[model samples]
Target: MDNVISVILGGGRGTRLYPLTKERSKPAVPLAGKYRIIDIPISNCLNSYLNKIYVLTQFNSASLHRHITRAYKFDNFSKGFIEILAANQTIESMDWYQGTADAVRQNLRFFNQPNIDLVLILSGDQLYRMNYQEIIKEHIRTGAEVTVSAIPAERTQAEHLGILKVDEQGRIIDFSEKPKDEKIIDAFSVSPSVFDRHGIKAGDRTLLASMGIYIFNLDVLNTILKETRKSDFGKEIIPDIIKKRRVCAYFFDGYWEDIGTIKSFYEANLKLGSPSPSFDLYDEKAPIYTNPLFLPGSLINSCKISHSIISDGCFINDAEIQNCVIGIRSIIGKNTRIQNSIIMGADYYESASHIRANRFKKIPNIGIGDNSCIEGAIIDKNVHIGENVTIKNANNIEQLDAENYMIRDHIVIVPKGSVIPSNTAI
Candidate 1:
């Protein structure tokens, strides 16, 4: 682990998660109540005792940079540090990151340093906790040129993921990216023995799907990038390199979700309030780390909150919250009913005089106002929901672009710093 360097890919534009990604990168998007999506992988790396990490981002990286800089600060004596490598127009290449492999290629100078044996590549937007030391251990034991963390996927999930066929020795022989045809997908399936070895049911028709978590021998990574012109790993590089290199599959059976879309983003946040969440953030032994805001406990006054997670410094007064995740510094006014939603709370709290001034000027201060009904929505930071506003989207719109908000998958997304006037209906 000491000889390994971790690179988290956060350079995607994240168009699928539009309004959320409108102001920040995908990795910077808020998760649960207080944590960001990048926090998951970074925390996992820290828990594995791998501290030298580089987060690569090209689009809307300001907030991500601030959060990382504030949250992770190593002691002066230690060499451990988390650095941000934003896309730059160097003389060698003036283009932005073309793809995953190209992004690594452009930043080769930083990673091609001393005493680095393995380069562990991970996605920043995934929601899962993995002990990367296990993958590195297997990579060392097997003497593999490249090792990919894979998971057992059913047919429904296999179509969208990178499916691979492995032999008895756990070496990947063939790979396909998002094959829609059933016959082609079946051909890329692994044997039942593979599932049995991973403790999965033998009768299940599951194929080994790449989780996009890879460990590359430093020398091998340098060689592949120098020889090939492929842009992406899953789409082009891995499929071509499996024939020339010893590419092994590391099976991982755990909770993993790629919340890159609006629907998935919404569901993943809402699922956190469930009785038993798939991803556990409350694990004390391997807890997720984030920016420590020293705010007071949430104050609830005559509110009925059920199966919800309310973060710090919330002022809830006579509100009914159900199956929601209320973020830090949230303020819910009286007679508000919110369900199946995620309120990303405020970045900063307004003073008493500021609130009075805003009220006098007829400006909605922050958070939900009184007599509001919000369901199936994602209210980003600094949103001011006015009184008597109905944001139910009763039409069940699959998609729409309203003046105040956007609707995707029947979920209204109020982008950051939006203001909805009073008595508005949607």
Candidate 2:
């Protein structure tokens, strides 16, 4: 459990996220106001007391690197360190990583270190709180070459994941990458028990979906890297090698989400505004770690809040905020109304204005004018909304200034420092 080296894959192009991925890697995408995508995995490693970590990233890794340096600075006593292994090709291989396995094969220095027994492979794009200690113990006890962290998902949902099939002894008997064959009874289900508990028919019991998290022995990782000819581990390397190796499955029933697309990112953030979110960050046993900052709790200025997460340095005036996350130093003006939205960083709402938007994290600092109304929009950093602006309507999709601004979920994203004119409608 203690002698483990975690390697997080952070090399996704995030094509579905488009503009959001335009500036940074998928793992660097801004999450829940104050956190980034890579924070989840790093926090897990920190909380689990696993010190040595290597993040494999190449696509837009600048922001990701900066964040890691600031967020994860190891202490002298802990000696645990988080390092970013960005892609750097030379004469031997002058190309970016083609797949997950290729990323690790390029950075073989991780396994070269001493005193590392287990290699923990994880996805940097997921949001969840987990303890790797349990999975490590299972891997060690099983004496298997590889141990995969799996979950029960539905047949339809398994299409988005690497579905698996294991025998009674928990040995991985089959592995398919989003196979569409219905006759395949050994397919993985997203939540078999959930459907069974909810009275839904047992669509597929062999539907063991892989969470892309694996625990491997240091020698096993090195051997796999040497034997593997492909770039990706899941789609190519792992599945190909499983034929001659001992592969087992470790079931994970905790809250896990993959923020790989715009829709998924939006939905995942909205989940935080739920009455009782499935993902709990306040757990004492395994706390999510973040860089400390000095700030007071949120201040509601005679406002009415209905299910929202307000961080420190927020001042909500006599307004109504429902299902929105107000970040630090955000000042909601008097008589303002925000609903089912995300307010991140520093936001300023003037008096008598109302807004309803998803992914409000675009703007690091934004100010809405008085008597204005915005809907279903993604306002970028340092944006200014004039009076009487109509961003979203019944259509729920707006295509404006996309050449200048990035688009996520069809929301009109005003770029940083953008100022909207009066009587404007995006």
Candidate 3:
């Protein structure tokens, strides 16, 4: 691990997760009421003792840059640091990162260090806890030039993921990126014995889907990037390299979800409120790290809350919240009922003077107002929901884009800093 470096790809625009990605990069999106999406990967790296890291991004990176700078800092004694490498134009190339492979290609000069022997490539928008040293050790033992971490996924899950075909020696012989054709997917399915060898239950999940996690030998990474014009790792690099390089598959049967869409993001957040979540946040040995705000404890006044996670500095007065994730600095007024939603709490508390001014202007405060009903929605950071506002999509519309909100996959999303007037209904 001492000779390894980690690079988290945060370059995607995350169009599927729009509204959330409207102001910040995908990795900077808030998760589980407290931590950012980028924290998961960086925490995994730190826990694995692989500390030298670089985060590559291009779109809406101001918040991402700030969060990284504030959260991850190393003492001068240790050679551990986390740096953000935004897309830039050099004399050699004048374009932004075209794809994942191209993002790494553009930043090769930084990764081409003498002490770095192995490069770990990871996706920033995933929810998982992995000790990367296991994969690194396997890569070394198998003498694999490129190792891809794969998980057993069922047919429905494999259709959206990069499916792989592996030999008996665990070498990936073929790969397909999001193949919709049933024949192609079936051709890549692994046998039940494969799962047995890894001590995992097969259950209907016969195909091995790529987790978009990779461990590459530094020399091979340099050679491939220099020789090819491929832009993406899954769509181009991995598929092309399998025929020429020793690309192996490291089976990981853990809880992992690619938070790529509005629905997936909503469901993943709600899952955390369950009694036993698949992705554990209570693991002291491998705890997730985030910025410390030093906020006061929540003030709950007779609120009927159940199966919910309320963060720090919340003031809930006579509200009913169930199966929801209430973020930091949230305020819920009286008679409000919120269920199956994610309220990304405010960044700053409104001063008394500001609250009075807002009252004079007949504007709602920076939180849920009294007599509101919000269900199956994501109210982004710093949103102001006026009194008597109902946000439930009663019509069951699958997709819609309105002035203040948008519905995708049947979950309403109120973008950051939005204001919903009193008595508004959706």
The TM-scores of all predictions, comma-separated, are 0.98, 0.86, 0.99
lDDT of 3 at 314: 95
User: Taking the tens digit of each residue's C-alpha lDDT, what string does model 2 give over 1-426?
Assistant: 457888999866877766667667888766776677788898898788887889988888887898788778867897577888888876757888888888877787756777778889899888888888888877777788999998767666756788877666677877889877776633343345543442435445436688989988778888888875678778887677777889988877678888787667767776787778988766788767665556777777677888777777776677776776655556555556666555554433433323323124322124554445544444444465555555554455534344444445665455545656656665
Model 1: residues with Cα > 4 Å off, grouped in runs: 202-205
User: Which candidate number has the best TM-score?
Assistant: 3
Tens-place lDDT per residue, model 3, 60-113, is 999999999999899999999899999988999999999999999999999989
What is the per-residue lDDT of model 1 for residues 292-402, given as tens digits with 9 covering 90 to 100?
A: 988999999998999889999999999999999999999999999999999999999988998999889888989899999999999999998899998887988899998
Cα lDDT of model 2 overall?
Answer: 0.70
Tell me which of candidates 1 and 2 scores higher on TM-score. Answer: 1
Poorest 10 consecutive residues by lDDT, candidate 2: 356-365
Query: Per-model C-alpha lDDT, please?
Result: 0.91, 0.70, 0.94
Clashing pairs in 3: none
lDDT measured at residue 62 in model 3 versus the true structure, 0 to 100 = 97
